[model samples]
Target: MTADNALPDCVALRIGLAARALPDTTPAELVRVLIAVLGQPLTEAKLNTLKVKDLKTGANGALSEIDDMAALRQALQCLHGEDDTAAQAAVPTPQPDAEGRLPNSIQVACASNSGERLDGHFGSCARFLIYQVSATEARLVAVRPAPATTRLSIDHSAERVKLIDDCDLLCVLSIGGPAAARVVNSGIHPFKRSQPEDVALLLGDLQTMLAGKPPPWLAKRLGRATGERPPQPSEVAS
Candidate 1:
């Protein structure tokens, strides 16, 4: 079979294991939850664009360790429980600090460059995407391309960094440490891993990060709608 046709089975298997382990949740629910956790919307556009390379590259390491159905089931249970505990532990308690306010809106952007010989280090050109997040939801608003000149631009990078710095939450993918460091220095933590599905997972975290509590926004959004507060900084850091 074509590798693409094989991906759904792989994705389903990964998610199903997590589901069987977390009997409280179903494989379908977990996939939906994970799609949100990874900050990916469950939509036809996304699913249509889903690539085997993306799935295998991001999940191959995890998948390789699953030797059999029993092993997979055990691993899923462990992971599901871990997720549950982590969610519960992240519940935010009330506090009085302007610092804890949830963002009203978020914008994300991506950029790539033709210069700087990024291919030498990464064996390809660098692709940069940034997400700006708020309380209700987050959006991918900007993409920065590499500079056209031989040397990189301090001014351009600085500009992009500033935009990301202003965000209450920022998600970055594929940009190297030096570029990521710019945002990290601004107090926004950067997740080094970047895959379409992984991005979806991180997006889920952004919702929880804003909610300041156990059970991320995606769960709450799916479970019910109420006045639950997102978790606090300490809760998020843990």
Candidate 2:
């Protein structure tokens, strides 16, 4: 469902204000706010599929079932306070190595709706399949689930970008301009594919790239892995 359809007018207004007030708020934090406001535990899968109307319907439905308006109001106030505290807290940024080369065994994050294919868009994936790759091998590292809802705000995009901040590359079917910019700013390269591909096939291709002389980006990453200096700007340009 779209963001516009997912929430009631009042609920949407409240969330919009909170989001605007806290421009750096995380997607997980927004999910918590929705949970509090809606009075229900919404799953990431369900939230992913909801449009704005759907969100509104869900919020209205939940409110209709609740007989205690005071209780609901109190719960929302508590949640808003928690969000404020979280927004004000400092978040540590990841630093590049002394040599400024990408790591040897690079971490790559693939956007997938299911676990098997690289089909999801960068901004709206159901999950991210992470892999640790070296010149000779690739291994599955972790699977990060998407938040319950996609807010599509810059703050939400920043939060999602942070989720894979450790990674060197992001593979997805498509990515919006804003989302792509955020990913690059976080020091992750965004790779877009025209169609979904098998995860194994993609990994095999990556292994080949690593085994051979990689492109500029991968070369730099390989330099980090092997303790060699990355190519200078002039060298890369040549």
Candidate 3:
């Protein structure tokens, strides 16, 4: 986008959002850096060619303001159209009961990067996907966005844990010992998966376990007596 001519509304919107996503980057500054990298009108083609390294270039290290890689990636996503807008549309809505709770269900938080997938690592994911799961049903109750923070920091890990403090379980591709300890101390059990998978499938497995014979540790949460896999909380749809 040139200085004399105003940007198109669509382009302006995206650029404004992108600027905000990067820490300390103003629309003017982002435009300046972008112009330096891509030159002239900032079309999608030009934006696509822009790389993370390019963001760090410019006079006096102008783009050096972006120190947080997570936020930097987030800003790039805005220009790349990989942020929340498209994903949020596809995210499932909460299906809590009249009392605003999923009866006989436990809240599970999945570390997510893009959409409704358990693809992100603890303390680094873009968001925590909160799901309310019962024996026969699993519904998306909330999608909590994680604060942009430097990875592996004790302080930021606590902040992330607080985001899903209400959840019973936390699922992720991986979690570090310290972060996992924080999660456990917060009364949220951490479950690690070796690879990325649909959040639904993970909840589905939990649902099946709930529907049948759940493990002793898990059964206790449902208020079931030892050796009794009660499906009392399983309320069928009317």
Candidate 4:
């Protein structure tokens, strides 16, 4: 298989593991796993362009031809099975905020195309909606347009990362492996959602997580923000 048709061993392993561990894994979740593993943007168009045989070879002899999204979903389902009830039950219940405030508020950058929803992928978003979030509330801080040139040049991914360097978290429809790594390396957290969602709803969820005992990842984010100095824009390349 050509390099482009090859799936990295790490990605294949992850897909296999996720299929087994989360037997009820949904297509959206599978896509998230794929994007996270590849560390690059993945679109339906890109996926459809890949041949089934090529994908099978790349998957280390694990997968067959997935000609379309439906086929891809079926392939993922065949790897395991789905249980919607269990999946829904797995979600944590929201808890009330102790003091309606966090030790420190965090800034999040949401990738957006229309400015109304979190509908854009990290690499292609028209702008980022910045929000300052606390345990009880989230407030809009800024709407920063994406750098025009960065999208045209892959090498400028770092420049794109710089645009949201000040944010504690980045929420997007999707993000590639390399860009996600760059974001993490810069001390920012990355989150992927399945589809376009209301920005307000996402903020509410953040608030809920803060109000409750956050997961280890989120707790670490909160802790990190307490001691770290806010990154300066000048520190990033123009």
Candidate 5:
């Protein structure tokens, strides 16, 4: 049996969303997982009741459904009627000041396949989502697609760097060592994350750091002279 009769497109759409959320999972594999966990033809009501723990405990794959909690939550949320496309559309922006900047804000670039998510790798992300973030606010300033090419190679790293050169930082799930070197050489700090998450959530964490005694790297990014900030507690003598 198929999802044709279930929840008026709910099962199918939710499946697509869940699959998208777990970038590492193919729809066929997810369907198998659903079949095992939810039994036979999945329904919207059944999908709605899906939980992160269910997948984590029931499914096994490259991501293992255990390692990527952020992804699991997103997938479950998608199944639970949380619309990622709608969330992407609802991502709001903060108005910039006359100078086209937010107060004490810095430009940040996120590698993403989806519109406002930090779910893509540096070398292969479809687009870059640029945001202006300060202690109090964050704004989605631009969405720049990668320069189209016949094929992607290390040489394209420089092109990608130039694409977001105006940004202060670049965050991605993965980046080649050479590409990271190039990014640093271009004055853009490259941050590598272990998992994909919402761009807004990532920016919110940055905002919180900005409101406190930020770390050396962050303080440097915020224009504080390197020597002016105190060392992290862990760095001090035992």
Candidate 6:
């Protein structure tokens, strides 16, 4: 079923407000935060795809009837709280590192000027924005979306792709192979892993490339393959 029929109108409005307010934020980022904060239901009972028929029930009245008008008050309440938290988590100022590099995980690219762009990939939306750079490389980061105060206007998929297509870097924690392939094929790299250790390793590799220094380990691998230097660390920054 379409979201219009699945989701109530008030939910749509809340989502719209948040989407419109993100200026440079993407729907993926919002969904990331939303999922992080809201979480999913943990019922062990799995619903079957096939519909069940009540063959034994009396014909006078169906065993169950649709009550589409039932209030979605509870879902709306959850959305409202989550939206607030997500909004506060999205402030875009870069924090400092000892070497003055804006941690590699958050870094977009090295600019001639003192500025850089950061990409935040949340569920269904890919948010990209340039922030005043305080160092050579700023770490790309992702924050969860806030709970909704009102409603959602649309589903997350289309909105996310729109933002990703227009974004510079594709930073995300978890995405399927198909989606990952899309981002890579589009000439955007995906940060599939987002742990601190992974981010540090990624940053170190990128920094080495940026400085034109190839690590022996990487050089060996690349030599065996194409006799060319591996993708520069700056590639990740980009």
Per-candidate local distance difference test: 0.37, 0.56, 0.69, 0.58, 0.68, 0.34
Per-residue lDDT, model 2, residue 235, is 27
Runs of candidate 2 with Cα error greater than 4 angstroms are 1-103, 150-154, 225-238
Top TM-score prediction, candidate number: 3
Ranking by lDDT: 3, 5, 4, 2, 1, 6
* TM agreement with the true structure for every prediction: 0.31, 0.54, 0.56, 0.53, 0.55, 0.37
For TM-score, candidate 4 versus 6, the one ahead is 4
lDDT against true structure, model 2: 0.56
Clashing pairs in 5: none
Best by lDDT: 3
**Residue 236, model 1, lDDT:** 26
Tens digit per residue, CA lDDT, model 1, 1-238: 2212222443443443343332123333334433533444333334334332332233323233323455344434433333233212121122333444334533333222122111111111233444545556645544443221111112334555565454433433244455555655654444433333334456666566656654442333222222345422222221
TM-score comparison, 2 vs 6, better candidate: 2
* Better candidate by lDDT, 3 or 6: 3
lDDT of 4: 0.58
**Model 2 Cα lDDT, one tens digit per residue, 155-231:** 55666788888777788877767777777766677877876787778888888998888888877755644658742
The number of clashing residue pairs in each candidate reads 36, 18, 0, 7, 0, 39
Candidate 4 per-residue lDDT over residues 146-195, each given as its tens digit = 65321222344577789999888899877778777788888788888886
Ranking by TM-score: 3, 5, 2, 4, 6, 1
Better of 1 and 3 by TM-score: 3
Runs of candidate 4 exceeding 4 Å displacement: 1-103, 149-154, 228-238
Give one digit per residue, the lDDT tens place, for model 5 in 1-238: 6432332455655665576566545444566677677785677778877777678655454245347677788778877887756434433343544577776777899988775789877765667888888899888877787643222122667788899988777888877687778887776777877888988789989999999987766766666212344323222110
